[model samples]
Target: MQHYQVKSVDTKHFRLTQADTEIGELEYDSWFSFTAEIMLADRTRYAIQPKGFWGTTIEIKD
Candidate 1:
């Protein structure tokens, strides 16, 4: 198994990396919303959003 790290580039942007290599990135649409886009190194993309008011559950779509 490999370990990954989530590094915050700013308040709304982040990168997922392993062994100093970037695997993916996450960017939030807004400060108050959990809706965002995910882009992987392989070019795969996904959209994620909160399912409920408290955002305890997340819904991910490709």
Candidate 2:
């Protein structure tokens, strides 16, 4: 079975980590934008979508 492997938790956010690397996060209903690493294939990082309110849609840049 699959589970949300929580690596860290805090008042503002929580992280889901696997294989000693961060895979995803939950920012307490905050905004986020997709971030893909240049070197890592099939891996991406999602940062707190800057300067926006909750439920804001952010466009991704490649």
Candidate 3:
């Protein structure tokens, strides 16, 4: 298994790191809606948002 670390930059921003290198970034779209955009180190982009009931699930799109 591989492990990734999440470091919080602020209330709405976070960094995903492996070892000491950053692999991706997550930034919230809004406070009310749990939506975000993810940008990878390789320049790949994705959209992430809460889905299903009570926001228990999340959906990721490339």
Candidate 4:
């Protein structure tokens, strides 16, 4: 399993880090919408859209 650290930047944004290195960001769009920008260890970047009553599912976007 991989461990992630989330630090809140503000009410609408947060920073995602792993092993003390920043990997991405999570931003809230509304009550039930948000976006994630993640950078993998391989150096590939991905944009993810999470949606649901609690934002439990994600869809990858390019």
Candidate 5:
């Protein structure tokens, strides 16, 4: 099985890291509709779904 790490997501691009290198990136915002998003006080307890589909995974680089 192959795993992917989701680094950053914004209005521009979604950065992915793998094997200590940038593996892939995607520029899109059409698959999900989410709102009421608030800034996390502690950015250490939340994991999000990456933009990848079909049995893909994402992780943080902290």
Candidate 6:
């Protein structure tokens, strides 16, 4: 199974890592809203945005 680890980069930024390798970053617009920028192992970059309150779901497109 593959698991992701999230660590605090500061008050507004967080880092996402898997197997000790950096996979992406989650940056908050405030204390609430955020955008996630992720890079796959294939080097494909994706930008994910939250659609609702508390980020109930994420929006991603190809």
- Number of the predicted model whose lDDT against the real structure is largest: 1
Q: Write candidate 3's Cα lDDT for 1-62 as tens digits.
A: 88899999988899999988999999998666689999999999999989998996899998
Winner by lDDT between candidate 4 and candidate 3: 3
Candidate 5: tens digits of C-alpha lDDT, residues 1-62? 77767665766446667676765564443445321122232433233344456425544322
Question: lDDT (CA) for every model shown?
Answer: 0.93, 0.46, 0.91, 0.74, 0.46, 0.73
Candidate 4 per-residue C-alpha lDDT over 1-62 given as tens digits, one digit per residue, 9 for 90 to 100: 99989998887677888899987776666445566565555567778787777778888876
In terms of TM-score, the best-performing candidate is 1
Write the candidate numbers in order of decreasing TM-score: 1, 3, 6, 4, 5, 2
Better of 2 and 6 by TM-score: 6
- Clash pairs for candidate 1: none
lDDT of 2 by residue, 1-62 (tens): 65546643655455666665766665544223332222222465444332346545554334
The residue-by-residue lDDT of candidate 6 on 1-62, one tens digit each, is 88999899888778789999987776665665556565555667677787876777889744
Question: How does residue 14 of candidate 2 score in lDDT?
Answer: 59
Q: Candidate 4: worst 10 consecutive residues by lDDT?
A: 30-39
Residue pairs clashing, model 3: none
